[model samples]
Each structure stands twice: as C-alpha cells, then as structure tokens.
Target: MKFWRWLVILALYAVPVAVFFTVGVVVVWRSGRCWWLWWLAPLCWIAAYLLTRTWRKQLAPPAETGFVSPGHWTPRDGEAWHVVESHRRHVEDIAPGQLTDPHFYLQSAMDLALAVARHYHPKAKDPIGSLTVLDLLAAAQLAIEDSAQWCRQYVPASHLLTVDQWRTLGKTPAWLSAASNVTWAATVLMNPLNFGRYLIARFTTQAATQQLREHALGWFYLYFVSQVGFYLIEMNSGRLRGGAARYRRLQADLQRTADPPVGNEATSAAVTPEPPAEPLAVRIALVGQVKAGKSSLVNALLGRQQAAVDVLPQTKQVQQYELRVNATEDRLVLLDTAGYSDAGATPEQMREMQEAVRGADLVLLVMDAASPARRADVKLLGELSAWLEANLHRKPAPVLGVLTHLDQLRPTLEWTPPYAWREPSRPKEHNIAAAVAYTRQQFGTQLAEVVPVCTDVARGRAWGAYEELLPAMLGVLGEARACALLRTLHAELDAHRVQVLFQQLGRASTGLLRAGLAKLLDAPT
Candidate 1:
C-alpha cells in the first residue's frame, strides 16, 4: 500500500513534467529558467509530504501535564546545573588529530613547568617538588596558557621510545609509511582538478581561465575535506597510539616507584613526619571552594589562626598544620588545599591538589552552607572515591562535607547558635538541616559524613562545628593507614615517573645543538 501510494504521488508530480518536456514546451519557453520550473513542483510536493508525515508522527503529550519536548523528555539530576560551572572545571572537548594530539598538548604544558623550574634554580636536578610557591604559581599560569592551545605532550619521544643500550627500538615499518604516503597522495589526486593540474594549464589562456573558474569551488572543497580525512585516518592510525602506549609504560613504572618504602627508616619520614615522635601520623586534606571557610577551619583545627581568613580566595598552595593527640603524640597533618571552585584552577593548582590528594588518607571537602554550590565539591568526592578504589582496591578514601558559614544562613543578623539540631526548633536549624540534606542528596553514597559549621571570626562567631569533623577525619585516616603500602607505592611511582620524564626531556634538550650541527652538515647546500 505504501509503495502504491508513493508511486501514485510520483506519477502525480512527474507525469506533467514528462508531458511538457516531451511536447517541446521547454524549447518554446520565454525565460531561460522557465525550462527548470517543472523540477521545483516535484521537490515542493516531496517536502510537503515529509512535513505532513513528521507532524502526524509526533503526537503531543497531554495539555494537563504541561509542555515538554518529544520522546517523553525527563529531567536529569544535576544536568541543568552542571552547565553553569566555572570554565576552568569544565573539560574542553578536544577532538584528536585536529590541529593537535595529546602528545603535543602534554609537551606544550610542561614547557612552562620547565621554565619555572629553571627560574627557581633548585639545587637538586631531580623532580621540582622543592619549587617555591611563587615558582609553582607562575608555572601553573603558564601551563594554563599553554593548554589553551596545546602544542605537544610533556613526554619526550626518547622517553616514549623503549631502548636497549645497543640501539633504540620501535621504529615505524617502512611499508606503513609508504602506504600512508601513497594512499594520501592518491586521495589528494582523486579530485579531478588536482590530477589534471598540468592538463588544465596546457589549455589556451581564456579557455583555461574559464575552466579553472568553473571548477574552483569543487576543487577547494575536496582539497580541504581530504586534508581533514588524512589527519583522521592516516596520521592517527599508527604513531599517536604507539607513542601513547609507550608513554603509559613510564606512568606504570612511576606508580610502582611512588610506593613508600616499608619498614625503611630513611624514606619513612615522607609519610611519617619526624617531629615530636609520632608513631602513626595521618595526612588529611581540606578541599573546597573559595570562602568556604577552609582557612578558618584549618586555623580552628590547629586551635590557632594558621590561615588568613578573607572574603576573597586566599589559600594558594598546600599548607600543612599538625594536630597532636595522645601521650605518644600521634599527629593528624591537615593539608589545607587551595579552595576549589567549578571555575577550575590553573594547571599548577590542579597538580598541587592532585599531589595533596594522592598522599592524603582523608579529605575534608568544605562547602558554604549559606550559598551552597555543591557541584564542584561533590565531583571531587566522586573522583577521589573512584581513584582510591582503582588504586588501593579497597573502599574509597573517606570524604566528609564540612558545610561552613552557618552564621550567614538566611537571617544574616542571627548569630545565636546552640539549638536543637537533632530536632529542629528554629529557622536556623531548619536551614542547616536542609543544607546538609541537600548536600548529602547530591553526593549520595560518595560522601562518608556531613558536618555543618560557622567559621566566622570578626564577630566572634568563629564557631566551626568541628567536634564530629575531627573524629570522622581521624577515623578515615586510621582506616586509610591499613593500605599505607598502596598509598606509598602510588606516591613513589608517580614521583619516579616525573623524574624519569624530566630527565629524558633534559637529554633531548641538551642534544639539540649536536642534532642541529649534524643536520646542518648533511644539508644539501
């Protein structure tokens, strides 16, 4: 029935055109375009048919249920809000082999770090961990700038290429290169103009000019598309993937090296700091957004003003504060990470944060209860959880939400605190409960615990509800210590990988002059 219907429609549209052309109507037409007018009638009919089918296929939902798009549109949790985050936190969707690749991107990013390391002039020639705060900041900015337009990966080709002292390995197969070159050339010449370049040039001036003008649009269109196709297929097929796989070897080796030595005194100081003789020390990272009272919480945790409290962002690098307890002086080293935001951090800032997180046994993700934008904080929790699971193969690192600035909740004038939190009695308690519930709901199972606090000091409301926070942090640290070997290994391996890559880059850079001289001598002058 459908086929017959389509046949009838075609006959209704095409029959008249066939009749008119057959009867010499086109030759007798006054306007030159009049000959082509029959073509428009069938096209319009087909378009109208498609339009009618489309409208009938999509039936409207009930008016009583309100308006919505087709396919029973349903709202996704956090999807709407995710779009409003800071530009920094959002991942730029970069397509491979389109003016860039991961290798070049990594290289371009590390250039800033290299320059910063040199500027700082560290005594050690290994990894630049001893870099000053200012140096790190500058490197971070440069990394951000470079990332805006990536040039290459941070790993050197020599580092990526596996070698046995006798000779370097993994050279490209001659056949592969030959095939790619021939295929690309053939594809380029597949365009008639590209193949007929000489033939067209041989024509008389006027005739050649007219022919070239007529084919110019088709010529350029095919040329541009072919280049894009080449990047996608030929250039992408072998080298990029091979280099990336080789590079991962460096990462794996590093992860293994990052492992802290077990029962070894000399390197034990890294995880177990030497001061006041603490048998078991735990590192806790305080992570959150700017003005989320991270600094104030740090000071409160140490029972001192360790961090400067400000309206604007203040905490820059990972600052440490020691929390001592018990006769043996077991310590909780609170690593105050820069307040994070959805807007994202500079590359340097992210690196420092990762370093802190990598070593930390526990994370205190702080969020402002008064003005809650918990997306960034929640994301960090899920990421840490996933990372811990992947690395330690145990439960994810425990994350506790430290919802600060309770004083600014709703009635900004209200400073009073002591209320029935267990059984809400006032608006303040209601708001506090709501914020905690909302945060927990967003985080779901990712968050281990949530505690609300007010870290204001100027008005003597420096009341951070840290009583539960301390216990929770201590509990997580103790649990994390069970997998101390894994954490240590991860750290050591990462450090070693960085050192190796940097060393390879040094070798490559140093050999530049020799390489240039050799090339110059061999040049066909």
Candidate 2:
C-alpha cells in the first residue's frame, strides 16, 4: 500500500518535470544561437547560494529564554570571556551532521564545562573532577530549569504535547512532500521564464532550511554553554557554597535584583520571590560641586536629616546613608561625597570622589539649577565616565542628574507643587524647563535623565523628590541592580580565591607534619 502511494505521487510529479524537460530541449534545438540562455538556471542557483550564505552570516540564532542577560552572563574576566567566545565560534562552524546526534548537546555542555573549569582550576589534572557531585547536579538542575521555563513560556500548550506528537511535528509527511514537489514542477512548466524562477526558489528553500537548522542548533549549543558556564562560575567562585537550593535561591534573588517589578502588585508578588533578609544594596553616589544640595538631596531621599546640611561645605567626606526607594524594598545606599571646588576639583578630591563613584551602583549628579557654573561638576563627571570606560571588568553605573534649587531658578517666589517642566506654561516652569534642557545638553549621554527638584523639606519646599527623583531612581533601578550583582560576584570571586589559597596551605602543612611523624616513629622503632 505504501509503495503504491509513493508510485502514484511519483507519476504526478514526473508529468510536469517531463513537460519542462521536453520544452527546454525543443527550444534549445531550434534556437542554437540563443542556447547560451541555459546558463541562467545555474546562475540563478549560484545567486541563491550566495544569498543563503549572506543570510547565514547576517542572521544570529535566537538565544534561549530564562537565562540572565548576555551582558550579565558573559564573563568579564578576559580569560573566561575568550573561552566562551571561542566555543561560540566553534559551534557556528560545526559540522552539519553533528546537529542530529543525541549526545551533541551533552558533549558541547561538557566541553564548555571542562574548558571553563580548566581556566579556573588550571592546576588540577581533571578540572571537572574537582567539582562535587552536588555542585554538578546543582548546575545541571539550574540549566534544566532554565530550559523548562523557556519551553513553558514560548511553546504554547507544550505540556499537552506527547512524545509521539512532538515526533510527528518534526517530520514532514511523505505524501505532502511529494505533492509539493509536483505542484512546484507544475508551476515551473506552465511558463518557461519560470524555469529560472523555479531554480531560484528551489535553491533558496533548500539553502534556507539547511542554514536555519544549523543556526538553530548552534544557538542551543551556545545557550547550553552560557547556562552551564554561568552556574559553573558561581560554583568555582564559591558563591554556590551553600548547595543547589542556596544557589537557586541566589539565582532567584539576582533575577529579582536585575528585573524590577512590572504590571500590577499581585502579578509582581506572584512572580517575585519573598524579599531576602539582606536585600542586595544598590549604592547611589550623590556627586557635585560644593553647595549643590548633595546633602539636602540625600536628606530628601531618606526623609530625614541624616547628613548634616551646612553652607560651608558640610559633607567633608563621603558619607553613606541607607535609603528605601518607593514601592520596592531593594536597599539603596546613598553616598554623599565631599563637594568639590567651583572651578575644578583638586586631584586629591577627584581621587576621593572617583573612588566613591567607582563603588556606587548609580550616580546622582547634583547641580544647582539657579547657578550656571558646572565646570567642576562636568570635569568630575567626565573623569568618572572615563574611569568607568577604562575599567573593562566593572559595569558602568547609570547616572541621574539631580538639578536642585528649582525654586530659585526664576519667578523665585512662585513655588508650585506640580510644575510641568516638560511643557512649561508658567514663568517658573519655563525657567525650570530651560535648566533641565541645558543640563541635558551639557552632559549629553553622561546623565540618563536630568530631573529638577527642590530638596529643602525643612522650608516646605520639597518637590519632585518623590514624584520625579524617586521615580527616576526606580526607572534605572533595573540597571543599577545589574551593576550591583556584578560587584557582588567580583567580591565573591576574590573571597573564594583567598579561601582556596589558605585551604591549599593548610593541606600542605598537614601532609608535612604527618610525613615527619611517620619517619620519626619508624626510625625509633
């Protein structure tokens, strides 16, 4: 019955193909001089191949879902980054048949694990052997969870799909394939010009399918590497010391740290894990020239007088204040640095301010809206940006320009509660608007946003702190959280390295003592 069905399909397909072949022969025989037109078919095929190659190079495969962002997951360490990138290139250039092997993904995952393990644990003969069974299981568990989450989110009704159903979906029906070929041949035979079109279409379809398959498989390989590599990094760094549960909890916390709450409270609460006992602290550095309202802004954020505000450069040193921004309980540490000189910061002061900025997750560049002098502010900000750019390991903290003393801008006495600086109508609003624009122009991309605020809450002049500044802070909290996580990871890596060094020393000393004792006892006996 199957043979008969295939025979019928071949008969249907052969009719149109035979017609096309006959027409080509007759045309070529009659028009001997124009027979060179036959070259067009091969040329079209060549063009199709070129186009497919171009697409293959241009198109990147879709990355797996549920993994942390590439920027975050990708190693900042030079040696580690090189290893992952090399693996990626290897995958891209992989043999076509390798995609179909059941163990291809496993092998790729193992290779990545071993490669990264060797880099981290170079002394070990079998780097992977150093990992505890629990560590390996934990890493595998996280990878599986990530893949499962991706399937759940992207593949609709995935749970309903059985093994047979999945296999059926992957396969093309033989009857349908035969019918399609016949239909395509008929389409080409109906018009001789369609011969070229037919060649191009066939080549394109075949090339595209091959390229798509390769890219899709390549994407999965890279995704597996990224997932496994990320957890491996944590394991090797000693951050996963508490076991799989602890690692998973840490991962969930990092996710929450990086991805801020979206949609309504119920949805956010449902998706978000319970607040950690010690929420990751996102440090915000308030930096500007003397009397730029740095302390006042800090006071406003904290809703109390924590940092002493004075006319004669009150904050002589970098002071940190614990702050809880609106809505989320993610701890924010506000760093109020010593205000710099109006002309330009001293080299010593610059070093101090830059150090504070370096440690910070975010920067609040306080500027006096009433005063136009920003040389010191701009110089310091430029230095900080330059420093951040030079440091390849650290993520650049997002900067928010806090334009203070908005009440003292123009129409000085006309302090309105809700001044629409965005689209100004009133004189005070217009002045505030101009200041914000000027600040933005001066800073360019340095500041994410410049918000005008009056932070003198003692004088009943607190505006835009909650409505503008806090919201702006929240807007960049996601990015700030990412920066914070990178810092935490680095700290853990350092601590882990130190711990490993001491452990090796302890082992060496213990071995030496045991050897000496054995020699002494044997000789006396």
Candidate 3:
C-alpha cells in the first residue's frame, strides 16, 4: 500500500515538475530566455545558504523520553524481560546453514529486537542517535522525487517513470550529496562555455535583462566560493575535529552522572554501582568461534595447555589463566572465552564475557586460516570494535588477528615446513602470506595486526611455524602496555570524579531533609 502511495505521489508531482524543467531548458536553448534558468538558481542558493546558518537549532534531535528510552528500563516483579531476551533467542534459533555467516544472524538479532521493541513500546515522535543516519535516508527519497519531477516533461510519454537511474545510486551521506550539488552549480558558473551562454541569453532575451543575470551570477559565484571552500576544509579536518569535540562532550557528560537532573526521580531512587578500582594487570581476551583454535593458541603462547581445547558446549565457559610474562610483580591475565556457537551459555557466562571485554586492554581474535569461509572472524572483530568505540569505560582494545592452522590450508595431506617464513618463495609460504593478506583486508582498520600461526605441527613438519606469530603477539602486548596504563589512569580519575559528585548529592539531600524537619517543628497546628 505504501509503495502504491509513493507511486501516486510521484505521478502527481514528479511528472509535471520534470516536464516544466525540461521545457524551460529547451526554451532557454532556442529562445535565449536566461530567466528560466537564473531565476531558480537564486532560490536554491538562498535555501542552501540558510541551511548552513540555521543547521544547529533546526537539526537538533529531540530529547529522550523518560517513559520509553533504554536508559529508563527498570524491572518490575515478573515482567519477564522477554523482549530483551528475544534478541539472543533469535541468534540461537538461526538455521545451522546460516550460522556459518554469523553477521547474517547478528543482523537478524538486531532487527528482531527492534521489531519487538517497536511493537511493545510506544512509537517516538522524534528519535535519538546519529542525526545524520535518518536525515540522509529522507534526503535520498526526496532527491529521486525531485529529479523525476524536473525531467518528466522532457522525457518521452511512454518512458515517464520507466527510467529508474536514481534508484541504483548507493547510500551516500546527505552532506556529501549537498556538497556535490553545490559543486555542479559552481562548475556551470566557472566554465568558459556556461559564462558565454549566461551572457548571451540575458542580453538577447527581453524577459531576462543583463542586470538580472549579473545579479543571479554574482550570488551563484559567492555561494560557490563559500560552500566549496567549507566542503574542502571539512574533507580534511572533519573526522579528527569532530572526534575530539565529542570526546570532550562525553567527558563533561560523565562528570554529571552523579547528580541526577531536578525531575529525574527514577535515577535518584535507583541504586548505583560503586566506582571501579584501578587496574592491577594488563588483561587480554582470546575470542573466536568454536574450533577456531583460540585455546590451542593460548596454550602455545603460555607454553602449557592451561585452557581446555576440546570441551563440550554445555560445560564450556570463560577460562582465565595468569601467565608471568615479566619478572616484575605485573602478571598478565589471559581470558579464553567460549566460542560463538557454544550452545546454552548461562547468563553467568554471558556476564563473564561482557566483563572481560569491557576491561580487556588487547584482544586476540583467533581464526582458522584453513577454513574456506572466514566470515565469523570478520564479524566478531567489527562487533567488538564498535562496542569499544561506543563504550565510555575504556578506549578501543587493539585487536591482533591470530590466523591458526596454516599448515591445513587446502590440500590437507600436504605439509611443508621450516621454509624461510619471512619472505615467501614456495607455494605453501605464498599461500600462508596470501591468507594473512586476505584476513587483514577483511578485518580492515579494526585489526591492529595479523600474524599467521600453525599451532600444532603436521605429521612431517618440523615446527608449528609460530616464529612470526610469537613476536607479533609480544609487540602487540608491549604497545598495549601504554593503553593499559591509560585505562588504569582513566579508571582512577573517573572514580574520583564520581566520588565528588556523590558527596555533593549527599549534602544536598541531607540539607533538604533537615530543612523539612525544622519547618515541621516550627509550624503551629
């Protein structure tokens, strides 16, 4: 029904606007009436110019509603929380075949969760989160409509809606699309041919005089200068500057967490967790799908099989080991989590995994290079990276990709070893290199580094070929030490900040309580 409504709207508005624009263009070409072109150009310039000036107030997202936001989720006795659990249930219910592509299941989980939430909860008049995401979607829909309207008249009668070139364009950001539009208009103004056309059409036509064209062209050039210059600057400095500003904003927000706003009655009644203590040692989390060889790699790194390699799914859980990597008091902690497809992980197991991920200074995303489809590893990395970026507790953990089972690459019977691991000369070595390259490319910027590992030596191979993997792991940990220290410092500072805020809240509460008591005593009955 919605689709048919869209079609009707297009037919009514789009066809006529397109025809009008087309006929105007033709008249401008033959009759030299620049008014048809220059007149609309000024209106567009004014609109875009005003958009730039009033963006802040006009584009601000509505404040979150206390009755419905995720921030307001409070448990009632026997409410079941079935909606929240529905997301995880969807993951568990995925068909065995689609389980291979974990991303598909993960996306399904989010989609199902949103659907359930929408059905159960009241709809929002205005939504939150990145304003750009919603804005771009609307702009894309509108752009297609506008394009159709302007071109309808010029287009053949039989082909009014047949051309759907606009539908094929990829999802481009609104800001980028707007900049490109300005660039197109500016190109016309700067070109030698367009300048000649503008002048000749204005002087030759009775309706569009020379003065009006000059005025229109002047504003167009001014817009070109301002809009293009701003776009160029943003192309260079936008991400870095925006990140810094957001970080500062987040810090300011965190500082105010202790003091609930005047009418936020829910937060005051809710019990808050104690501030975290400073970190004692660097924590590294080893994560992957089942049979991806995370435990075997952990054993190789530890020089002992501390983690269970082949546990049954029902009994599997997060395994922790303390390996003394250095002579000093600082002992590194390694957490080996249950694989992605591990069946029936208790709520405790899930909580343990979340805690480990939240505190991890570095993550070793183990993958089986021997496997044909490596989608699970890529999906896991993306999820963890996004989690870190969105989380306020710590900075992103540096993920080092550990590609295990290199010896099992294709031709399972074949085993080559002791080859110069650094520079590849043989087919097997080249295959390993190619596998590592592909894994790195798949993970993209999420993975800090990728190192190949053959944990168990094949029947004839002399070594497991862990030469490169060990050193890379050490380098990652060494780099992560600074990040570890930063995490500790941030924890300490955040704790102190929370402590002060709570104290102030306590005093305010106490003063109010005492004042009420005094007023009660002084008042006559």
Candidate 4:
C-alpha cells in the first residue's frame, strides 16, 4: 500500500514538471527571448525528478540480509541489520519471547477486563462492587504506567542517530529522505519565483503574468491538499502517550450498559427495595426562570440557608450543595443553575443547564404561584419541556413542580387553599369554610397534595413553609424511587472506572511497541 501511494505521488509531480518544461521550451523558442528561460525548463525537470527519486529510496524497506547475519552484509548495512538484532536481544533481556509476542498478552488482559465489566453491568447495580469492573479498571491503569516507563527508557537512544547512522541502522531509508529533501528544496525555491512573478504582474504589463498567477494558484492548491492528507493520516495513526484508545473503547462499552432502565417505573420499584443498606449518593439539578425562588426553596428543604435568595435573578453559574434527608440520613446533591429567562444568559448557559439536568436523578421545575399565568413563565416552562423531550428518552428524573411566593395570594373570600388561600390575618368569617372550598376546587384531583410556601427572602420567616415542603417532596420520591436513583449513581461511577482502565492498557501497548522498535535499531552489533 505504501509503495503504491509513493508511486502515485511521483506520477503526480512528474506530470506537472513535464508539462511546465515542454510549454516553457516551446514559448522560449518561438519568442526568441533570453535563452535562460529554456535552461529553466530542463533545470526544473531534473530537480523535480531527482527529488522524487531521493524520497522513494528513503521510503524503501530495509534489506532482510542484514538481520539474518552481519558477516554477509557491508559496513553500511550493519546498522540496519543490528536494529532487528537489538530488538530481539532486548526482548530476551526482559523475558524470553516477551517482545516477540507482547500483543497476545496485552489482548488477553484486555479481554479479561472487558468480560469482568460485562458480568457486573446488570447484576451489580453498584458498578464499583463488581469484581469484573474493578479488575478492568486496574488493568487499564497498569497499561499506561508501564508504557510511560518504556518510553522513558528507550526514546533518548532512538533520537541519537545522524543522517548516516539513521540510514545505516535502517531507521529511515536514505533514498526516501533524499527524495523528501529534494522535494522540500524545490518547493522553497519555486515559492520565491512564483512570488516574484506575482510582483511583476502587479507592476508590469505582461500577458504571461496571468499564466504565472494560475500556475502559482495550482501549486498552492496542491500544497493544501498534501497538508490536509498528512493531517488525516497523522490523526488516524498517531498513538497517545497513555492508553487513550483503550480508555475510549472502555468508555463506549460502559455507556452502552450503564444507561438506567426507563419508562417501567413498576419494574424499577420491584428490583430496588425501599430499605437498601447503603444508599448511593445522587446529584439533583434544579432549573427554572429567574425570580422563581429556586435558592429559597432549596434552603428550605436543606433546613439551612446554603444558597443566596433574592427577588432579582442572582444565580449566575451552577452551584452544588449537599443535603441529607433527616428521615433516611441519605445524602443528595442539589445543583442550582443560573436562572433561565435572564437577559444576560447565553444559549451556552442554557445548554450547560440542560446538561446538568440530564445527569440529575431528580429535577425540580420551580414556578411562581403569583405569576404562573404570566407569558414569560409559560414560555419558559414550554421551552424546558421541549428541551427535556428532545434530549432525554426516559422521563428526566422525577419532576417536582414547586410553587413559590404563596404569601402574596389572598387566603379567604372563596379563594383556593393549595392554589389560593386565606392568610392567617384574614377576617374571622374566612375560616374552615374558605379552606374547605379552596381544597375542593383546586387540590381535588390534579396534584397529590399542594403545600403553600412563602419564599419571601426579606421575611426570614418563610423558611417555615420550606420546611413543610421537604417532607412532601420526600414522600413524592418515596423509598422505591430512591433505590433507583442510587443505582443510576453507581452506574455512572462504574463507567468512569472502565474508562480509566482502558486508557492504562493503551499506554502499556505504546510503551512496549516503542521499546521494541528502539532496541531493534540502536542495540550494539
């Protein structure tokens, strides 16, 4: 494949040189201009041909005779032959047959790790506990550390070869290097000539100037094509210092098995019992429009003011807080994101919020009871719903709709309790009758139960309402939901472990390859 590619490259360069020379000669002869123009045609062709040949020679495979026996080869061939001999010697030094067939050992280790991870995927909901997952992770880490050691040991000697030493050692073929050098020299010389022609075209009146411009453009295009091709090859073939490939593969596998079961709430509840001995820690993200009182609500549930609360939009970035439910003593992480619908927020902010919510085991969509009917609030809700549908296949965590600013609503005068309520200071007549009517009308069927929350930041007494909301929120999630949430969290940890393992493996492979190559080329004959 490499030889054919080189042949095609030579053909491409040759065609252009032949055309330039033939055209240049014909023009010079007809015009009776300076004979130098005619000389240029032959000079360009010879330089181009020689450069191509040098590149090809350098690329040629090293002679096999040097590896078989040094006595049968010339002094120049000795270096090339010694590289292979040295590689074998290095392998023997480490362990007999270790360098010769390292791939089999590496592959076997990878296969074992992969099998272990797979075994634990479904049964061990807590990915960390599974023996297979842990083994895979350890394998990946070991691979990378080994590779680093190998590179440190061998790279210095590999870089010591001079042009002759390199050729002798068969590190790189002489012909290939010569051809590359010729091509590079020609390119450097031609660029100045082409630029000069462009300058002349700008300042002088010459019909040939346009032709020169076209030729320069063609060369530039060819250069760009070559550069692009080189980049593609490098990107595809280059190995990382660490086991990045193995890590990526492991990540892919984990992602496939790690996704939590969705839609079947009943089945999930059955699988995960309410009283798990140890609950997995979970992160929950709360997102909503500005002035929806997200911070105030979180503070109320936490039983402490960990987040800043203000009537004005204050949260600018995602902030996380650890909350432990008094009932279970199980820890839950609450991620409060910058308020949406703020003028300063960009699309990227919205995207970050979306991603935060995507990873959450629960999402709280807070709305203001005072302005639930407002256009901005409605639009925000619709947008959030749309985003959720587009991004998530399963229902994004258990969504709890929180209504804040309940203190502003009038309690009595035939108003609702959960939706509308009579305040404590209402008239004597506005008592149980008003509360009963409000409950019957609003909290009749739609919601499980509505708890009023006063999220007024200045009052400081509004924390009481938040206290009431917490127990209700916990009840809504229940023990079954908590177990599922724990499982999901464990799965994420498992995925991370798998990725780390594969990355290590890739590193080890790279080290082995580099070490083998170095000894083959640099060892003393």
Computed on alpha carbons, the lDDT of every model, listed in order, comes to 0.52, 0.72, 0.51, 0.48
Ranking by lDDT: 2, 1, 3, 4
Rank all candidate structures by their TM-score, best first, as comma-separated numbers: 2, 3, 1, 4
Residues 166-222 of candidate 3 have per-residue lDDT tens digits of 433323456665775575467576554556444432333312222223333433333
Which candidate number maximizes lDDT?
2
Worst 10 residues of 2 by lDDT: 1-10
Put down candidate 4 lDDT per residue, 250-318, tens digits, no spaces: 333333222233221233445433444454455667776787788887777676777877455454568
- TM-score-best of 1 and 2: 2
Model 2 segments more than 4 A misplaced? 1-95, 98-250, 261-268, 314-316, 507-525
Per-residue lDDT of 80-127 in model 2, one digit per residue for the tens?
Answer: 656666676666467878877879877877777777777767775664
- Best model per TM-score: 2
What TM-score does structure 2 among the candidates reach?
Answer: 0.62
Better of 3 and 4 by TM-score: 3
Q: Model 4 scores what on Cα lDDT?
A: 0.48
Off by over 4 Å in 1: 1-278, 311-316, 326-329, 389-395, 475-477, 483-525
1 or 4, which is superior by lDDT? 1
- lDDT of model 3 at residue 166? 41
Candidate 2 versus truth, CA RMSD in Å, comes to 11.5
TM-score per candidate, in order?
0.40, 0.62, 0.40, 0.36
Global Cα RMSD, each model: 21.2, 11.5, 21.4, 24.1
